[model samples]
Target: MSFCKSSRQQAILDAASELIATIDLEQRLLYLNPSARQLLVLPHDLDLEKERLTVKDLHAPAVYRKLDTEIFAGLLEGKGRWEGELEFRDSNDQPIPMQMTIILHTDEEGRPLWITGIGRDLRRRRRLETQRRLAKRAFDHAIEGLIVTDGRARIQHVNPAFVEITGYTAEEVVGKTPRLLRSDHHDQAFYDAMWQSIADKDRWQGEVWNRRKNGSVYLQWLTITCVRDVQGRIENYVSIFHDLSEMQAKEEEIQHLVHHDPLTGLGNRHLLSERLQHGIRQAKGQEEKLALLIVDLGHIQLINDSLGHTNCDRLIRMQSAKLKAKVQEADTLVRIGADEFALLVEDYSSLHDISQLANELKEVLQEEIDLTEHRVTLSPSIGVAFFPQDAETPDQLLINAQAALLEAKKAGRDTFRFFDQEMSQEARERLKLEQALRSAIKGGGLSLSFQPKVLLESGHVYGAEALLRWCHPELGPLSPGVFIPLAEESGLIVDIGSWVLRQTCKSLVSWREAGLSLPRIAVNISVQQLEQEEFPDWLEELLHEYDLDISLLELEITETGLMKNELKALMSLARLKERGFRIALDDFGTGYSSLSYLRKLPLSTLKIDRSFILDMGDDPVSLSIVKTIIQLAQNLSLDLVAEGVEDSCQAQQLFDMGCPHAQGYYFYKPLIEDDFIQLLAASSS
Candidate 1:
């Protein structure tokens, strides 16, 4: 029985995967099993009895002190067995951590006999424990909400981020499924597809609408991954999600800004194109006509000068609101340019209806708009183009509509015109002319012609009017009647007028240097030029630069131009008159002949319009109108000049009518600078 027990003990020791050793009471090594020799890096052939090694030799001094002072001291103090951690040194003096059990054997009197130790290597277990602690910390502090569910889809774990995102405590959500957070925004089919993807590919990711614990729906970007065990069976599902509600809201706001005008909240050019294309498609399907009307508010610059830009913008917004009220919900209204709005009319029956609509729009805008300081009327010119008749494409339609608009403005503002082939040709010519004119202005291709203004009674020259003349390299001389309106419409009149003023000043300086005396050089100014608040100061500075007196320059303004913005025009002219500059009201009796406002004007001269002068010989009404104008100018104490004295009969009629001055072919049609200088020399001689 004893032999069997010993054999059993030996077999157990040999089969152990740990270090097994026994030592005597003197601390000398007695026996070591195969496992103990391998663990201590000792040779299997070593004879422990021949070369006795003590337990202290296998341990560092500090370790042995610890074992003796703490572990062994406890065991010797009537503790039959002890189990704890300990360290031993290998052959290379490297420490090996061990989880150890020590047993003490004694006789009946309880005296110590020998010690037996069994230890297991703890390096791998310690490394695994450290990795687990780090992973848990990362899971707890991650920014994205994390969730872990068992194979049955029951919630098993949730991170703090998950709790915060869902507005739920871990205690309340530990065993609930993800369905608890469903917003019901998606039908069963959506969830079915999601699960199908997960079951097939072991992962799924997409946007999802979910409800928080507070019962509010929120959008999130969710990614779910399946976790498998060693046997390749589903163990858990790990999900990561980030809230996207705020981000989606920002994206929508950006889209709105991209498609809308900031000042008027109307659809911009981009939205116009989109809606126009869609409208065209619908119109084509239904075989109906659609009208694209481009409404241009004329005299915006005049209004802008009257009201400051802030008030001007307010007026624009108000006008846009009124325009919006006139369009159907199916139709689109867009602000495509400053002072320009476009309306897309759908489901129109006939051209007459489109015309009526355009007329209605014009009338709507013509109604005076109230500003902070002024009530002003808007002269709206509308251009209409029909789908399939004018153009088939969006770009072509827009181009055609704009061409028609230019024609409407040309015919006169406060009107509307339909697209036609002739208008298209005219638009192209106008564009070419505008480009060439800009080049001419830059390259010194423009020059001035002087039309001598003579005294009707003496036949002596008083002064000359400086007329702007442009001779294009290819198109030759262009009529002022044609290009002048073009320049005014294109807003190039301001720059051109400035150039003309400077050129006239230079001419006057040259004539003065040559000892040729002229009373003043008359320069015609447009309404656009007069609308400038800085014109008075700028003109004064130009004169000072040339060392010329302000009286040597006569600024001629048409009655029509003056009435456009009476307040601004009066202010500008009053400033000039104060500086001793000559202010002549040209084309008298032609426009807004309100003697009330006319008397209020500060004027030095009034020129009778050529139309009445040309007809005075044949038409009694024309002759009477001219006589009345002469009397009006004389009564107003304003000097008189008769324009377009073509024959001696007209000149004799003007002289007989007591008209003081006359200018026309009868004196000299328009002379060049050198020729006009010769004329001035002759008159002086």
Candidate 2:
């Protein structure tokens, strides 16, 4: 509750990753940490305190007014803080984009004393947006010629390329008839046949010689289609054509050598790369999207290792045919490697469309393929990268797509992954951590921290949740958010989960033996742990090994974990509960758990997730949700505990709402074993 800044507080602020600035009650700048100064790019000679700038000076006029009206007003009304994307101006009068979070610091007497602002620079995000705009311009002015005319054949609209290609500007061609470009190269009977085809089918396409404004004849591959009104009558004539005279012979030679894969007859890597670059440029120009999919046939090497190269080649040919049949002509499929292929898909509508095609590719490969003298089946691991979204360059796009494909393969084959920047980073980090965690779990470097769950009404310690924390000697303290998922993904959670259970039970026994009056301890249970068939038996063995009472332990499982295999999870919980182990559904109200379904589970407590409780102060919808959840817990005859009760107001609100138990920084953060035991002893005293 102290608004005063100590040296330790200043140190913490200075070390923070985000820019931090503190303003006093009069709104004058009180402190600017190194990060804040760096973000503002303040000159060395300019002393922040000496210059005496106010908080309002840091922001643009309109932004300051809006923040004062909305954010400050809400803070004055007792809301804790406000956070949003805003522009902060530096001393040079240039706007710096920031993701800003500001908090109003108040004294114990509830008088506002300080306002602290933390901002993260958004230059990278802005640069990406600017790139998209530039790409869009390139797409719009691309080299394809397009012309639209009235049903009477009078030219109505033409792009800039049309003027450049045909030697006629829009001013001269706007109202001209198509007859203006007619060439004597096509006889009267040929014109009649073309018009007859258009009349019959509403479309005509072929190579035709046309004269430009300067009287030079050029060959163009022209496609013209009749556009119809809603009533189905012809409204306009649309024409798309590109000059193909000089490049025709050159394209044929290039196509034969560079484009085709001799083995599968699909496009090769060179052609795929060219198409990817062209597709990206086109996507940028049209403000559309193209997707590059890298498909690796899983277990193909194993097939080659077993059935020889001839059989493997046959399998590759079979998959190529299956995949090619599914793709449209506008899309390009290329064989990039012996077992890997790439697809350059243009005009994709959304991520959903790309995923659907990836799934179809996976499905097609999964089907049985006949090889001479052997019947074989293969599965595909697919990775998709989007143009002008994932990367700007062709190489980066392909690399990212291949990274996603590697991720899919790592996550067990026959699946597909879409390229995301953070996911790739995390996947790489996860691989490193997986190896480290295997050592950490076995090398006795892992430990536990306990946060007491207190009674909301009386502020008495009711129980504690055992949280797992890791400190790698080399990597330093790793967050549970980082390592926990790695454990789950690498199938290391089962072993780690066992270690936590045994260690927590041993800690509880030691606490009781030392004469501390501690209540039950809750440990998180992962889906992998719960799904283990011998989990209940192992729990019993750990309880016996520690010589601890089963009633002293509680198991916390997430709502999503329970829903993963409802029947199996229910059975596991039932068996554990029968052995005097309490079951608490942690992070309640975050997942799709039904009240009717809750009635069937053998759960004893429902712990509200922190996110919902965080907004209970100002968000009416959150308040209603918490209230409904509390009511539902009561109806189900289950004890309710709210997580993240960071302030007295949230605690008092939950208590008044008839929710009895809570845990968060309002009372304590998770502590080491010695500190936790001391806390319990102090609480008892």
Candidate 3:
């Protein structure tokens, strides 16, 4: 064929030219299409060969260097053949960054004839590549686990953190939905809501349990966001989270510190107050009655001072454990003070039911506690105040129960008291006094005294009983007989009692240190204090802590006190005996069935009632009673002590009746702590 048929040649040329124009190449570039010329910039210097340029060049620097290489130069030697683009600086001398393709043509024998180059800017593609690299780096090192999914919820991407947290690498998770990480903790409603939120192009945040690499459970605080297209269709979902294990642990610790007693792990005042408030609201709503119990652990201080603080702590823990075991989930048990615990019976059916429950509690507390190689125990004195009947307010309810608790202490240890209308005024007064007592304790307003219990045969100062004497500013010198009963009633007896025990033990110890031939000092226990389940423990603790000789101490309990809680009192006395204590039966004849009861107790001494001793000389029957008491003690081989001897005759009469030990006014009235110390020194001298 000719070079081209006339018509076909023009058509082909026109078509070729149009194709170049469509790709945005200008007319000048298409016609000249020289590699060198295409890579050049618009002329800024004097024209070379009188040539003129129409447009600026667009080529990267690397492109220019490559095109100048020998390999590329040889490729274009014969005809003009070029491929790829080259660098060209603009008039400002800053090279334009661009990419282009070079074209080569051959006439015959594959020899190149003409070369053409085309270019396109590469800034957008480079920008996109840089961003991809950055995103990959971030995903690899992120602190939070990430999961990415398409609109169908099929997972597309999972970062390394996800594999670390979940034990699933991208290969295992890429095709799975987020359900793979779910712990199945949520129900249909939860998932429904989640899906609904995602469908609406919204976000979801909540707590969720997830699985770890080892198939263990983990808690996560997660956030999920749904990405949507311009048409409002779901595009993807992204979930990110950090493990909340440490945060959850901290939160639990905070909650425990707030709600539990540090000493016993029982609920404290803060927790008590919260539970009480909640209970009140619930009671009011349900038209129910709630019973409140104010429990004062009797004689805990004596044990604390005698045994040691460590032993005391152990005892307190034991008692709390016992109390917890007896209490139901609905019941709130609070160790509000050292020796005082409060129980709120929120689900009691009635007053009678509360009483029965209280009886059950008493029985449980009476159970012997085997501790530190000894069986120690004390009973619980429960004072109950019921809803609507005893109080209309929370504070009033607590007050009423406290008042009743005081009454129980006054009556005897280990007994429960219910609120009565007549106790309202007394309760208010008692409340005020208790507040004052609390202030006094904080302010250190308590004092101690000693009462000498003389050795009847020796007629000299021997051992003394340490007594608590409160030096009140507004109220005169408060006797153990006065404020102690009050203190015990108000559950303040624990601290007061603890202070007394410590003071007595310390004083007695100092006396021994001072070279005094002092006898053991006795501390009378209150009914409220004697009932503590930890009584024996505290006694052991105090003895060890103070490093006192337990045998040098005497603990006297009244028959009525013994009867109040026979099992608990017996256990405490048994524990004390095991610890080498001198336990005496005080006010022996006063109880109705003293003679019958005496034989069964773990007592070392029997002290006849003062009434019998006071009238022994006048009433022949009184003398007979004394003689009978002596014979009974002789039969049992127990030491005999006489109390309340007013004169020499009373002492002589008891002595004549063969009583072994006697203490009363005939020996000496009670002395202050300092005076008792001085007497012990003088007597030994």
Per-candidate local distance difference test? 0.89, 0.85, 0.74
RMSD of each: 11.5, 35.6, 14.5
- Model 2 Cα displacement at 14 (Å)? 99
Assess candidate 2 and give its lDDT.
Answer: 0.85
TM-score of 3: 0.49
For lDDT, candidate 2 versus 3, the one ahead is 2
Candidate number achieving the greatest TM-score relative to the actual structure: 1
Spell out the clash pairs found in candidate 2: 139-285, 140-285
Worst 10 residues of 2 by lDDT: 135-144
Kindly indicate the candidate among 2 and 3 with the higher TM-score.
3
TM-score-superior candidate, 1 or 2: 1
Each prediction's TM-score versus the true structure: 0.63, 0.44, 0.49
Full ranking by TM-score: 1, 3, 2
Among all candidates shown, the one with the greatest lDDT: 1
Error of 1 at 85 (Å): 33
